[model samples]
Target: MTDTTRPQDPDSRCGFVAIVGRPNVGKSTLMNHILGQKLSITSRKPQTTRHQVLGIKTIGPVQAVYVDTPGMHEEEPRAINRYMNKAATSALKGVDVVVFVLDQLAWTTADELVLEKLSSLKCPVILAINKVDKIEKRETLLPHLDMLSRKRDFAEMIPVSALRQTNLLPLEECVGRFLPQSVHFYPDDQITDRSERFMASEMVREKITRQLGAELPYSVAVEIEEFKHDGKTLHVSAVILVEREGQKKIIIGDKGDRLRSIGQDARIDMERMFDNKVMLRLWVKVKRGWADSERALKSLGMNDF
Candidate 1:
């Protein structure tokens, strides 16, 4: 005879879930879709996510802390690349569930690297093949799904279009089932684990990603030196850090046109995010070879390495 017992009460379910994948796999987009807010930045550029951002979701009696990590990649051996890889790997520790996001259209060598890592995790994993909308037919997905499933022991395999908000609820339900029953870790009203300054910096960097081409996006980082709020207005000052003078020239653009455009877009988003009027000041600074410097990487909240 088989003994079966019901799981714990719904009121006790709470835990952390990490989303891991290669760049442009729609991890951040899916996290925002689930939380129904833009807590993390997203862009078309590869490696758009540079840090591990936590977005919280509360439904009925469960609170799931979802971490969106930087895209895993094999790049030049540098401090930043090491930091990114470290940050992505660190999310697996103590996680209740792992959501391995993949681009259904383009599953390349980098995706294979992420898949190899996911195969070794002991916890429950859900293979989320995102961007299904981009694919022409459903049958085309089978080979990739079969290939991945055979290579790993994922608890469930689900397809989703993070950009179109399709199949996300089903994916959430799958992840929810894996979380252990426990007391809520955060209040229901809270949506994210990052601070306003951190989010603002990310917003600025995202704007850079959208406005600038691919070559310059990954080399850029934004630092918020000051953020002050009065009743009616918020004042913000940020510095866009680049790795070299050529990148700085490109970021500032001809006669500051590019910088102004980036600042305008970022300011608009910040105002919407903060829900108040804002006075934003943006400056571009060149820090040659900073991406490879441990000291510089540590200063950017990437001290974990």
Candidate 2:
């Protein structure tokens, strides 16, 4: 009989790393770039992410399980907003390292709120100065970097452009140093903890968010009515929930053109993600005050975090 024993590497490292910051600060973009895939949904709108997304990257013997959290905001006027805040802060617990993302040289009251949470964490925190490509003068960043250093004793600070994929290797190296040595927690080939169904809903929601822009508020939510695979084609039916009839009409657009465009764009992404032909159907429904009701949020699966 042949022996089938697998030996563990002594140098292998694995741990959770939380990516956190104020809304629209490129936290999702940073993790997507680092993992070399789009595991988290992103938009220009603040608080685009409402749950905790895990993007796992395994390189050689080192595995970094990144928790891509919803951006922390100062306001929690609605139940959904409070849920997002809970999701973001929960990612910090038991994390081996924390990557605090900041936009360029700007700091606001929202960033101050995130800083207050970091003050109590015992783990290492690394400051990632994102959108550095927007800075016209390189010399101007030194003074800003010095000012940031005074705010907290970060484990490491590196300037990076998440969109341009610049200087990210150094950032990854810095995060890897703080991870503890242990056996790999997940398979190397697996990229995310989210299921295909969850990703499908996110793809649909991303299209809606991008299409509506400022015309629509955060009251929009997507629920997958049907997800079935037949032959070589994947069929998906998603219902878009809104707080008011006017919001539904806006999403439907004149002659349903906007809804068609959103569905077409979302199908393209679903095809690429699943590597199969996708047939998508969308419907708009009015669900008033869903954002403010905790019961409604739980029914929509928004309270899972």
The true-versus-predicted C-alpha distance at residue 53 of model 1, in Å, is 0.4
| Candidate 1 per-residue C-alpha lDDT over 217-299 given as tens digits, one digit per residue, 9 for 90 to 100 | 46788889999998889999999999888898898989999999999999999999999898999998988877889898888
Q: Pick the candidate with the highest TM-score.
A: 2
How well does candidate 1 score on lDDT at residue 141? Answer: 90
Note the Cα lDDT for every prediction shown.
0.86, 0.92
Measured on C-alpha atoms, candidate 2 has an lDDT of 0.92
Worst 10 residues of 1 by lDDT: 1-10
Q: Provide the clashing-pair count of each candidate structure.
A: 1, 0
- TM-scores, all candidates, are 0.93, 0.97
| Candidate 2 C-alpha lDDT tens digits along 130-155 | 99999999899999999999999999
Question: What would the TM-score be for candidate 2 when compared with the true structure?
Answer: 0.97
Query: Cα miss at 219, model 1 (Å)?
Result: 1.8
lDDT of 1 at 250: 92
